[model samples]
Target chain A: MLIPGITIKKGVCQLLALNKFSVGQWLKTFDTIIFDADGVLWRGQQAIDGAPDTFNALRAMGKQAFICTNTSETSREKLCAKAQDLDFLIAEDEVMSSSEALARYLQQRKFNRKVYIMGGQGIADELECVGIESLPLDEGKMIGSQMVDYVKNITLDPQVGAVAVGLDKDFDMLKLAKVGCYLMDPKVLFLATNRDHSFPVAPGHFIPGSGAMVAAVESLAKRAPFSCGKPNTFICLHLLRQGVIKPERTLMVGDTLYTDIQLGYNCGFQTLLVGTGNNSLQDVAKLQRSKLPLMYQQIPDLYLPKLSDLLKFLPSRNC
Target chain B: MLIPGITIKKGVCQLLALNKFSVGQWLKTFDTIIFDADGVLWRGQQAIDGAPDTFNALRAMGKQAFICTNTSETSREKLCAKAQDLDFLIAEDEVMSSSEALARYLQQRKFNRKVYIMGGQGIADELECVGIESLPLDEGKMIGSQMVDYVKNITLDPQVGAVAVGLDKDFDMLKLAKVGCYLMDPKVLFLATNRDHSFPVAPGHFIPGSGAMVAAVESLAKRAPFSCGKPNTFICLHLLRQGVIKPERTLMVGDTLYTDIQLGYNCGFQTLLVGTGNNSLQDVAKLQRSKLPLMYQQIPDLYLPKLSDLLKFLPSRNC
Candidate 1:
């Protein structure tokens, strides 16, 4: 929560104008800073340079800094190990992941059901951690069938209640056909982990995220599922539950305006835009000229080269 | 030509609703029959089992059968080779691909300028064949780079005149970035080959068809491109040029109600829904429940199980 150089008077104006300087002031002002890992701290293994210094600066100011990554690839312990390797102090509770959020949400809801999953082990593990049985394969000959097939095949059974959609590697024609069939029954509740089309690029190349699979099934069944991560308000609620952020005073900073900035806008928090991630400035300008939501343009109170650039405006005392 | 067991009658309705005995009476009713290859005679490969017999039956009746496909994959020669393998006698000019339609439309418009293409060889070849230069790759320094990195990056060129979007495997982030940057200039005209999300299942896994890349760039740019294929009346106009089938008398047989039926309706052709491929019965049923476009649920005059199902309705002489 320490900004390195700005005076208190300058900090006040920064917050009011909500400019890039104000974002740095806000980062210094808060006791606990939550960072979205992908765009904020790092993209895959290559850490965003200055991420460690920023976190170290926060700790030097006697504030708590945590990484809230949407990635389900790493467990909390692994994340802590990575954080330590990056020269930052991180604890299990200080790290919140979509996988963990999904697990917690499922446990709290106590929706006793068998989730027919079309995703990765992270999704299945999350469901199982909540004491829910996970079914990975199609049991009722719904495979390779159309929407009407569900009514004829699986909906008759009370055991089959909900369908969970996520990134499924081996998901092919049979899985898609089955998901489409199952979705049309109307009795089954559908849940999409996230609606991202492509995740952050890594050595493996860009893989199709959950949204493509979700989109394929959604288009066929003509039904939208309950999305539960990133831009979804549910993730914001999870952040609030951890007592890490006060909605009115918090700021969400990231490279993508649609997800990170939009999340901030929805949560009544200030936002900062970094121009180095999923979307480009030209895309933003295009949206500005068209039917893009007004709140989207207004959502980001600041624009910075990257999250690290905020350091320059930090209050000297806080640093 | 043969419509399963139905007979043609004195009028259009009578011709559509007649039984096998009366089919002989309607044999001489229509002078031309147009077929869509993707869903009718064959799907990617391995012809529809009963296609050869149906074509032979129609040939016996002395009906002019024309194969009109929305595919951009094959040229007239390749299409003929495939049809021959399926035992259907098709002339080179009798088959019309959407690529040809796009070529003709572009040639007639006489743009006579460079086109930044993101499609197959068919599109590139068509443009070249019509004396137009293809300019798909990045030309020079892109506009909107606030920094002087443009001076260092040779890939960003500003000389592109137009962008034509079609199916291509080379569609990647760099291409999209270039397109986005070029589009920001406002002088580049945008064109899309088609708007289908997924094509028929081929030997390899489902490739990201043109529409996928189109949607990605379109979402960022927030603009609709000029469609040059099915559901767009341009191709229908091309068919009308050859005096092959009177627009009013033509029957468009396709499995997809959206593209095929919509194209048929737009072209003033009676549409026959063949539900055994691509779209299913429930897909149609869903449209019936909504206030969709007229073509969505204005039930086709005939519902054939497949293109082969039409064999039952052909005149006895045709069979």
Candidate 2:
């Protein structure tokens, strides 16, 4: 389980409030700062106020900033473009998204094989970029009783050595069955981008996340996938293998503790939870004392009102 | 929770080996017989040998029989027609399918409102026959990103007061979202036909069952529904309300213990497990001694090789 400088461990945590006295120490302690996209940087297409300047401030102090997101709808190139358009200057290489992480995972393992992807353009494009051909999920080809027939007649592609799952709007019974059938071969790896059950689009407006889709397929496949997103150290491990980010000298900043802060801790990084999104202070308080084994790592070492709040404690926004 | 003519308790059970001495007494004890269709009387399209003649012989002996199935693919009319084609003697009224049961449930509750059905034509036809209007989950209507916009732009039909889920081959992310959205209101009753995870279609082939679809929605909805099939007493309660089936005088027979045997107990009927489909003798043996709180009713009172095997103790079918 050892990956570079990262060591996985389990324990409860206490959140430390940011103050002027502790702000300088935070900026100089980390060589890289990893931030979650949706709630930490931007909500949908709109960037949270002062989020740009906060990253700039981190960079000005000689600390690198990376966007580590689980948003699977868009590819890394699109994510960089979107971030730039929102005034948050970002580069494609600095964007370690679930989509990109999956591709990296395949390449690092030297698994030069075609994939059957139950996902969207993010995964497809990433696979193509990584030189991994994907068996297309033809939406029009399968529906109603046709799904049964297709599954019956299906011949597993020998080239398809893996099945990659994510937040696929095109997810259907046919795709589910095909994946399950392919996974019947124990050697055929099952890879999921993330397992966030639901993500909030706006206040009180939540959509079923990729985890729901994953759960549906898992129910049929009778197995869990090697999920590459937060709370699983695979994403960070990928970064570690690349030699760009040092886990010991990294700070993980995010709005939610579950995927964000817990992921940071799993990868042996300093974790921070901001209160401007999905979870509340009370939610963290409950998880810190949670007896449920499932909530074991949902804790953080530090937290603030928002990522932008750190700007007040920074000296300058110039690198 | 005690019902008349039913005793509730616990402990391991022994499978009775029927002999000539006890066969006559077993036949005279129950005036009515409840059979689960897919695994017991039939497997997919083909009927188990001697199944048709067994029901006919039971009728000649003045015993009433019903085909109680969780297969939601076809309506009662179509089921009866299919039975006739397979040489099985079944009337429309005697075929109590999950689809028909759902419609009857709505009628019984007087919830005469439009339904949002995430199911097949069986449920649609049954609902129409019961005079309940439905908002169709037309497969062609929702797919890909269009699903996101459709879910967002969709206006809630105030008349839609319930959402029924079943075996839907067209099940996808869009349909999952729409149903989850509709069930946001606590007033919108959520109903599922059954929860059989995977059903064997052929010797080594299995298809993901209605339960997988239901699980997808339930994961998104964060709540379970009033599931109506085997193992749930609701279907039996519906029959009891009709005043034709006497619980004390009924015998429930099927191949699977999870649905058939537990359902028989849930409805206050004598249970008989047949080894013609799905489950094996070892499966039953394991369940008979299970101490899981949820599996208290899984043990059956009687079992044999098949329904046709009962002929050894009964008079010849001259009808």
Candidate 3:
């Protein structure tokens, strides 16, 4: 059903429901497709029904398919393995996780010093992939009960040049204190994987994301981190810079509005919102009614129940 | 020296330097005095010079002095003991800590459920003192490597009704997760000790305060906590309600502007800023020049190099 009262302006179709005809026309508009992993393709360990076939069909149609995920818990290798296990056709390098984006960002800057990581081993591995060294995560955990003694004896590694933050189950006060100490020197770079506040674990159940960890360190460090994930444009800079994907011909598909839709809007890509994830048509309608121009950026150009629904609209596929 | 550009209003004096005569007049203006312990009376374990004698002299002259501190790391009993150790004539009941204030807040509400504490033992002890039970601080620490397993096995205690956050060296993601889970039930109260971002440990050295812990949980919980510490009128409500102190005749003294002076401004109490703590005369001068009406609330009515400076100006004490 088409959402009522949303007027489509030139070059932007706000909350237009995609039918077979519209989907076919939409498919012809984008040569490159960026997919958000968690919500659009799968929910946790389970892939959205027919999502793999839809993704494969998109690639088979000569469209460049790239998976851009905000999850920093795993590296691209692991993400590729996960995607393959779910029967999606994917190349390892075509996937850009926030961790990978942050690693590339540091690599591009020629950052040579050791990193103080307040994230999981995924970030550490990504940095390692770029030949960057990170301090052992266990070193700061030895801060015993005596905070004063710990502060007095705290020896900041002079070689440490950056603090990379991501989602970590092991996040604690010791890490926060160490980050604060390192950040006291104005030269130390503060970087975050993403600022996504929370992600769904189950229906209506959400857990704290990397934003929580970043906020904690931010409170202590008294500074903001250079975020590399959506809606930050830094995540797709390499693709844009290398002319791999022309923005106008690219379609960004995801469930979340703030990250996926906003990123697509910022990058001048056509955005498709899928119901299998965080936001819904109702949310789009609410944003539409609010009349805030900023919120309008989060309203996707098209909407679908799930990514797999597009499979029927593919010209090569039998309805 | 008097702040040159500042103009003294009818009721508010912005950064008037306290000299012998002005200090005597200032002493006569307030019948009750509220002192901030950390920066005003002492820094770390060492007592600020002449602070104890100055405090005692004020009490000797029939002024009611109370130590209203934002430190939630210790109970009132411990605070009184520390004050006594530093040669201040402080009674156990005369000290009001953020922890104590939070405890009273819950007690006043007749809160019966167990508190999920994300703070030090001080908060737990304060809750216990007010006949409230808190969950064991170590229960959340046993969350092992597998977050999925932990989340799947997570059992929130039905009795837990509130999450009290303060400075905890042991603060971790597990606590944040638990708080997130508990807060999913909107009826659960979220309380914070204070929101002071950082506190001075030594000259030019600072450490993350309770605000860091609060910010972490806040990011996860997606709601602001009811802060019971300085600048929140709830902390001083009991004294004000009981007629123990009149706001106009009460002087709030401290080194921090945002907390102490802002609290004074909020409570209609005269504010005194001392240089020995987080803020200084320069900060006051800067605020004075900002011309923003809100910033003026942080500009103290009186200024002194240290709390002990008032000792020389007390009429009862010979210079």
- Share of true Cα-Cα contacts across chains kept by each model: 0.00, 0.44, 0.44
- In angstroms and one decimal each, the interface RMSD of every candidate reads 13.9, 2.6, 2.8
All models, DockQ values? 0.06, 0.35, 0.45
- In the range A1-319, model 2's lDDT, one tens digit per residue, is 1223333344322223334654565556679999898888888778989998888767777788889888777889999999999888678888878877788789878998889888878998888888888887656344656655666765668888999988887777767777777777788889999887776553334577888888777777778888988877887775687788898888888887778988987788887788877776677778868888667566776667788877877786342
Give the C-alpha miss distance for residue B260 in model 3, angstroms: 1.3
Please give the RMSD to the true structure for each candidate, in Å.
8.8, 6.0, 3.9
Per-model TM against the reference: 0.68, 0.82, 0.90
| Candidate 3 lDDT by residue in tens digits, A41-84 | 98888888999998999898889999999999899899999999
> How far off is residue A91 in model 3, in Å?
1.7
Candidate 1: where are CA atoms >4 Å away?
A1-32, A43-49, A59-65, A102-225, A241-244, A274-291, A294-298, A304-319, B1-30, B42-63, B99-228, B241-244, B275-286, B293-298, B304-319
Q: Can you write out model 1's per-residue Cα lDDT over B1-319, one digit (the tens) per residue? A: 3454554332113233566655554444466677777766786567887877887787777767777666664556677788988889878778776677766776888776677776666777666667878765332222232222322232434456667776554443345545555554566777777766554443222333466556655644557777777878787675577676787667777777777777777777777777657766666667667675564434455566666666777656623
Clashing pairs in 2: A60-A318
lDDT at position A125, candidate 3: 89
The ten-residue window of minimal lDDT in model 3 chain A covers A1-10
Candidate 1 CAPRI level: incorrect
